[model samples]
Target chain A: MNEEIVRLEDAWVHFDGVSVLEEVDLSINQYDFLGIIGPNGGGKTTLLKVILGLLKPSRGKVTVFGHTPEKGRKFVGYVPQYSLFDRDFPVSIWDVVLMGRLEHKKRFKRFSEEDKKLAYDALETVEMLDFKDAQIGKLSGGQQQRVFIARALVAEPKLLLLDEPMASVDSPMQTELYELFEKLRQRMAIVLVSHDISAVSIYVDKIACLNRRLFYHDSKELTAEDLEATYQCPVEIIAHGVPHRVLKEHK
Target chain B: MIEILQYEFMRNALIAALLASIACGIIGVYVVVKRIVFISGGIAHAAFGGIGLGYFLGVNPVLGVIPFSIAAALSMGIIGRRTKIPEDTAIGILWVMGMALGVIFVALSPGYAPELFGYLFGSILTVPTSDIILMLSLNAAIIAVVFSLHREFQAISFDEEYATTIGLPTERLYLLLLCLIALTVVLLIRVVGVILVIALLTIPAAISRQFTHRLSSMMFLSVFLCAILTICGLWLSYAFDLPSGATIVLVSGTAFILSTVSKSIHISVFSKSI
Candidate 1:
């Protein structure tokens, strides 16, 4: 029932001699929903990129399904952070979502009927099937996230990686997405990086606190000391700033 | 217009316009969407070096542009992506360096470059059969490359990082796209001249973008628009005794202004069906 999907060993990343990740080691298994919580600029996005092989770590090793990051990334679906691209880009939701099946298809070959069906079903799963013909840029922010999520799901990935998935989504939409993730986790391992601790505590089976380093546990409860170490701040401020339910278990 | 078809120069000019339009119509979409107009302009200006190299070597300058501009394109693509030097800054330097080299190469040649102005501002009416053949070949190459690899091009233009994550060799594809742009610049040189090549490259795609949401439609419409505008400009220049390249650019400019103004006034009369 338990098989390892991702493993990072003694990973250290430095950008121009400035350390972004320090001695971060993590292991994710099948059916695991691991949430990484951290402060702004806490290297959460960097960690995800390293896993995707987009950013090569300065030191240490990372393996996905026991293969190199680049080769194994075909089985990993990624939903990047909210809104880094041009909103005025001239691409339709259907075309953008269909790109998810590209790695599965041969170079220069057309998308097959099954590929279209999977993309359609993925859009339907995210309730964005109605906007298939609409330009991706014409949609609102939350709508765009759903489209990207649908793209991630269309590939039938063994591992799903999302960065800042909840950043700009509204409250109701956030709950919908969390529920969507809950359903998705049974089929694939899910790893989401967010600064929000409350949702992680509530939804994820395991939680990790990351600043420059990583500290995680099997249970959702993160000790106050872990939050302090990650945030480089006091527990009192976290209790005040975060939802009361988040720190209740810690206290 | 019917009588003009009998004249070989007129016929050649018209064919050149169609060929040039096809090249721009396809490559221009990537240029506009990727917002790499400056680098394109650099590639165009850098072809002047190739033009100069042709004069100095006593070969057809258009032929010289093939290798020269490809080199320019590869350099711009690689240096911009691989090195820390800012892309625009690199383009600026290369753009002027090529132009300077062109001047020097022509100066060193034995005789006066009689048709240099034609290459500068364009005299499409004087386009020879040899150059037309070259243009035809270049256009074919451009079409073949784009026809097969446009999906990858679209992927990079829409989101380069995402393209990389999905395991596309984004850097290599980008360089190939630049090479296509270089080839397009070669075809366009005869129709619009080096000075005005960027206009022909941009205006058609920019106009077509207003009315379409899909990439394929945008490309198709863009090619159609390029052909119409270039022919109109050529006719106007022929009838009124004006410089053909400048005339074509101005006509495209006017069409753009008109299209934008009409759309803004709630005329949305033309449905975006395409």
Candidate 2:
């Protein structure tokens, strides 16, 4: 059996007495590419935060690599939603990517040669080695997203979590990013939250449709009932030849 | 002009200026890059309350400001984080309340404090040897803390959520940064006065940012530029018989305008040619 990299048992999260996630039992394996699909403000980010140890679940247990989230998080790489940062912040691609090695260095210590090699290797994995010297803001949206991925990857984590990775990328670049993730999931467990259901269904090994509660299936195939269960309305799930899941107007 | 260095007071003022510049240059980059100019201003003004309390209590105002400003910085950090009060509103309240407290304390101090104006609008010439030593110690502490936590600071400043997700103790680091800013405020209050501290803290870093994309380079350039500004302003003030602190800030202000305007012009010209 593949090892469980992350396990959340009966997890519940609440903000200001309003429940965001309830009884979300999830288990991610060593090679799982799990796509989490949900509406805006539907506890997706809260779940991600819980898994990353940034927020504690109100109840239940969350263990990563058989340890508490805090201790286990060092082996996890995170690519947050891209809108929270100052785009014009004065940092080069090299500097931004090297930030991933923060946990590995001692106080007042310079980056080790091994750290440098890992950073460059991560950048190369994202095919961004050539632009390592460029300012981050100077890159296109797709390119900046790739740099963020490189930053996350530089730590060589066992699990990878990304929130809205395609939010700013152009439509054409979205497939390329998925392909990159496809390549990455071969080495580590990948969990991504995205609104792009069609591409997610095609590329991910499993899909978790979440609202306040979770309706998880361990395969890309989903019934119309799963769509309605998550969206809270009657909806159609149309599968095209491109391996996409298109939603029809509510009846 | 060279003979100015021969005077004891002149020598103290020069050394004071160098120490103050070191504090501003190092912490000022964080201030500018993090876009916390107003927050730093709020901390500086709130520090005036400590000065006033010191005078009211018959002790050193600098001593009073140390704890007072740290308290203010911490409360500001807490209020900004835990409450629904808009950060700008909270800063404004703290800024004015701090000054109001200072005024009340000074009014209650029972004597005419003539040197109060020197605290508001600094006179570098009046900085004594003891205060210079205090500033030097503060500079050393700032360098030490920043050196040890440079990566954490950079991470939090750039992407705090990402930093937290990676299990970095971001909240504690942020509060520590505020404390450092508090100390930096103390170092600058004697050089630029409470009224002009933010200008000294921000202008040189802003200028250095135009030439460097890295934080370390920005700090080094800011340190150099601040030294130049302080020395030239001191000379000009001596030559014209003007206020040294205000003159130094004005010089920096003028340079800020020139750098910003020239940058815009360069960008436009390059785009037009492109």
Candidate 3:
């Protein structure tokens, strides 16, 4: 079996005693492409934070690469949900991508030639090398998303956690991005989180639904019960390509 | 103008302004980009408490500011992050409280407070050589810290959650930035006074933001702009017999308005040409 990249055993999180993530269990293996879809405010970000060890779980065990989340997070690349909160923050695309190399960089030392080479490769992979010196905010929303993906890829991480990468991107770039993710999953595990269930369902190998509680299936298909329980309401899911139903109308 | 250099007080004032520029240029970029102008202002005013403590204790008020402002920075940083109170509310509370404490401390002192007006309105001409030495060292320390941690600072200022995912200690880095602001308040207390420190801390960086896409270059431009403006303000004050602090802030504020206006005009013209 491939290396276990992430494992959660009944993890729970509460902010001010309001349960955000309730008793969740999940696992991901190397090179696994998992998609998590849910409504907004449904603990998606909180779960990502828990895995990154930015927030501690109130109860239960969560580990990445078998190490505690804090120590293990160095091997993860995170593309945050917000494209760039402060677009006019005066950072160039090159600077944004190079931030991925910061974990490998030592104090009082400059980014090595190899680090720069990796960033160069990452930008090239995303076809954004031409705009390396452009200010990050000046780009269109699709271009910004690609640059963020490049930033995440620069670190050569074992696991890439993309929170809503398609949230702001238009449909055409969405296909291009998903195709890129397919190529990327050959080397590393990719976990794509979003509210658009059909888009995530099309490209990923496995699917999970998360509200306060997480309903995960080891395979790609999700049962109707899973959809209703996760959304807490009836769901009608129409996929992007050829006519398909993620959730058929329940009797 | 060149003849004024021969006067020791004038020379000292220029030196103080130059020293103040270093802090303003480097830390000011973060202040502007992070939108923490009010927090820096809060730190500046809360420093009045320390000035009062110095008066009550009969020591150098600048020395009193060092500890008092650091304490205030840490308190505000902690409470604002950890508690339920909105950050601006926290700042507003501490801002007036510091001034109130300073007022009471001065009122309770044994004799009439003579240097009080200078602390409030700035008296750059009267800055002791001792204060210059202090500003020089403080400038050195601020530079060293910024040089070492600039990468982390850039990361947090850009995207704090991502910085934390990479294990850069974002909270500590943020608090350290505030502490740097506190130290800067000390440096500027002798230049612009507490009330006007925000002007020097923000205007130069805001103007520099218009011209640069890189953080390092932004700092360089901001420092240059601030030094020139403060000197121009100093000269105007010296020639016209005006208040130095208000003059300095007005000079920078005018430049900020001009740069912003020019930028808008340039954009509109460029779009039309295109």
lDDT of 3 by residue, A1-251 (tens): 67888999999999999999999999999999999988889999889999999999999999998899999988788888865579998999998998888878886678889889998999999899999999998998878888888888888889999999888788898899998998889889999999877668567878899998998877777888888888889876655564434553556
TM-score for each predicted model, relative to the true structure: 0.95, 0.93, 0.96
Name the regions of candidate 3 deviating beyond 4 angstroms.
Answer: A239-251
Q: What are the per-residue Cα lDDT tens digits for candidate 3 across B17-82?
A: 999999989999999998899999999999999999999999999999999999888888888999
Q: How many residue pairs clash in each candidate?
A: 0, 0, 0
Ranking by DockQ: 3, 1, 2
Worst 10 residues of 3 chain A by lDDT: A240-249
Candidate 1 lDDT by residue in tens digits, A1-251: 79998999999999989999999899999999989999989999999999999889889999998899999898899999987888888899999999887777777777899999999999998899999999988887778999998888888889999998887888888888889888888899999998877556467777888999998865566778888999998755344353334443633
Considering every candidate listed, which one attains the maximal TM-score? 3
**Candidate 3 TM-score over all chains jointly:** 0.96
**Judged by DockQ cut-offs, is candidate 2 incorrect, acceptable, medium or high?**
medium
Q: Taking the tens digit of each residue's C-alpha lDDT, what string does model 2 give over A68-120?
A: 99899998999988787898787899999999988787757888999899999
Q: Candidate 2 versus the native: TM-score? A: 0.93
Worst 10 residues of 2 chain A by lDDT: A242-251
- Looking only at chain B, model 2 earns a TM-score of 0.97
What is the TM-score ranking, best to worst?
Answer: 3, 1, 2
lDDT of each: 0.89, 0.88, 0.90
